[model samples]
Target chain A: EDKVVQSPLSLVVHEGDTVTLNCSYEVTNFRSLLWYKQEKKAPTFLFMLTSSGIEKKSGRLSSILDKKELFSILNITATQTGDSAVYLCAVNLSSNTGKLIFGQGTTLQVKP
Target chain B: SAVISQKPSRDICQRGTSLTIQCQVDSQVTMMFWYRQQPGQSLTLIATANQGSEATYESGFVIDKFPISRPNLTFSTLTVSNMSPEDSSIYLCSVGQGTYEQYFGPGTRLTVT
Candidate 1:
């Protein structure tokens, strides 16, 4: 079965602190890894990483994928209360069907 | 990126009742999918709504329980039949814009009493 696992199921941190969320996957015909942030409703797209060593960044958030290691990491710097949300990791297989295997997600709480 | 929206953002219903959720996309998409997210659980693909054809359901999901209709490339609907307390979940509609990146709608929150 295709599985995506995330570490630190839940985390609490103070504002201004940096946090790192981890995602590891085991699937066949790997294609790309994506990160999303869910506040109270829909999940907003964050990053899509397909290459190793290279990092994709957006403002204070960044992510990287290590295909060989079958893992990825998302980093948030100088976090604020608004950054509190459930971070989801999903792996897209090469199956032309465009199916996504998602992780259980990491719930992050940034307190002021 | 495509903008997606869903109707009946949240609904509270009694057991044995049914609900139909609608999904609309700003742009025509080739692929539309329905997913279910149980409380505190990850999202699971329910089926692939194929335009002009019967939907392809995922394992553990049946058409009789969750019938889907894709009338066009930009619109789709999922009907949950004979609902039960265990059927309470958040149903999300996502569209694939010719890539692996799928954009999701706000989702329909269902609560069965």
Candidate 2:
């Protein structure tokens, strides 16, 4: 079956620390991998990686995809309390149905 | 990016009752979906609302329990029927702009007493 697995279910770190969140998937016909940041309300889109080895970055946040390994990693540099949220990774199938298989997610708590 | 909104941001209802959550997108989207998130859990796709057609439900989710409506491309609704305490969850509506991107609404928090 198609499934996405994220490592380090939960993590606590002090402000300014760097943390890496991992996501691995096993699915038929891989298309793209997406990352989302979910807080109290809803999840917000973070990054979508379709190619391997190329890193997508925004400010202190960056992500890379490794299709050969069927995994992805999200890195946050100099984390802040505002960065505390559940990071979700989802795999979009090549079927083009827009159906996403999501990971359990990694909860990051940045303490000040 | 598409802007999405949902009504009844949070509500508490008694068991056996039902609730319908509304999702509206600022732009016409190609696909819309309903998802459920239990506390501290990952989001699970409930169904895909197809415009002018019957919604396609996922495994473990039935139409009788969670009927969906997609009257148009910009709007959809999901009804949680015969609610129980176990049904209490955060219901989210998401819109697919194209092949790779999907945006989520604010979500409705439902509590069954």
Candidate 3:
């Protein structure tokens, strides 16, 4: 069975804190891993990591993938209250396939 | 970038009543997908909708219970039949962009009582 597991299901941190979220997947034909942020509505795209050891960054958020280890990590630097949301990690098993195995998201709460 | 939209942003319905959610894409897409997110759970793929063909459902999801239609490249609909409290979820529509990225619609939140 293909599965994606995320560690630290929920976290609360004061503003300016740095947090690391982990995602590990056990699936066949791993194509890429995607990260998303969900607030009150649907998730918004963050970063997609396909190459191991290479980091994808945008603003205060960044992510890296390890194909050999079958895991990935998302790091948020100097978190703000606006950054409080559920961070989702999804694994795509095939190319151009819309089917993605998603991990139970990490609930991040940034306190001011 | 492909833009997707879903009708009825949020709805409250009674159990056993059915509701059909509509999805529209701004551009022509070969692949469209439907996903369900239960309260406090991750998204689950319900089915895959392709233009000019029947939707392919994922494991544990049946066509009769959750019927889907893709009449054209940019439009699709998903109907949840015989709704129950367990059926209440956030239904999302997604479309493929190029070979790697997929864009999501603003999901329809369904609450059954």
Candidate 4:
């Protein structure tokens, strides 16, 4: 069965702290790993990592995938209250359906 | 990325009533998907709406309970029939526009009492 798992289901940190959210998956054939951020509304796309070891960054957020380990990590630096949201990870299988297998997501609470 | 919109951002419905959510994409897409997210839970794919074929539903979801219609490439609707408190959740519509990424709508928050 294809499944995705995220670690540290929930976390809390003060402003300016750094956090790493982890996601691991097991699928038939891997195509890409993606990250999303969800607040009160729908989820917004964050990062899409197709290659291993290469880090993708946007502002204070960065993510990297490790294909050998079948896992990915999302790192947030200088976290702020505005950064409080559930971080989700999903895998795009190579089978061409565009169907995504998503992780449970990690809730991050950044306090000032 | 395609821009998607959903109608009735939030609604309060009585038990046994039915509600239909509409999803519209700015650009034409071949495959659109509907998902449900309960409070504090991950998203669960309800069905994949194909333009010319019946929607393919996932486990624990059925066409009778959640009927989907994809009349065209850019428009789709999902109707939650026989609503219950258990059905209270956020329903999101997403489109895969020939890419690995999907663009999501604002989602409709349904509260059944």
Top candidate on DockQ is: 2
Off by over 4 Å in 4: none
Clash pairs for candidate 1: none
Candidate 2 or 3, higher TM-score?
2
**Per-residue C-alpha lDDT of model 3 across residues B1-113, encoded as one tens digit per residue:** 78888998999999999999999988898789999999989999999997788889999999999999999999999999999999989999988756666778999999999
Candidate 3: where are CA atoms >4 Å away? none
Q: Give lDDT per model, in order.
A: 0.93, 0.93, 0.91, 0.92
Chain B only, TM-score of each candidate: 0.98, 0.97, 0.97, 0.97
Worst 10 residues of 4 chain B by lDDT: B95-104
Per-residue error (Å), model 4, residue B6 = 0.4
What TM-score goes with each of the models?
Answer: 0.98, 0.98, 0.97, 0.96
Interface RMSD for candidate 4 relative to the native interface: 1.1
**Clashes per candidate, residues 3 or more apart or on different chains:** 0, 0, 0, 0
Residue-level lDDT of model 3, residues A45-112, one tens digit each, is 89888889999989889899999889999999999999999999998888856588899999999999
RMSD to truth, every model = 0.9, 0.9, 1.0, 1.2
Model 3 has a DockQ score of: 0.77
Error of 1 at A71 (Å): 0.4
lDDT of 4 by residue, B20-49 (tens): 999999889867999999987898889899
lDDT of 1 by residue, B1-113 (tens): 99899999999999999999999999999999999999999889999999999998989999999999999999999999999999999999999865568889999999999
Q: Which tens-of-lDDT digit does each residue in A1-112 have in candidate 2?
A: 9999999999999999999999999999888999999988699999999999999999999999999999999999999999999999999886557899999999999999
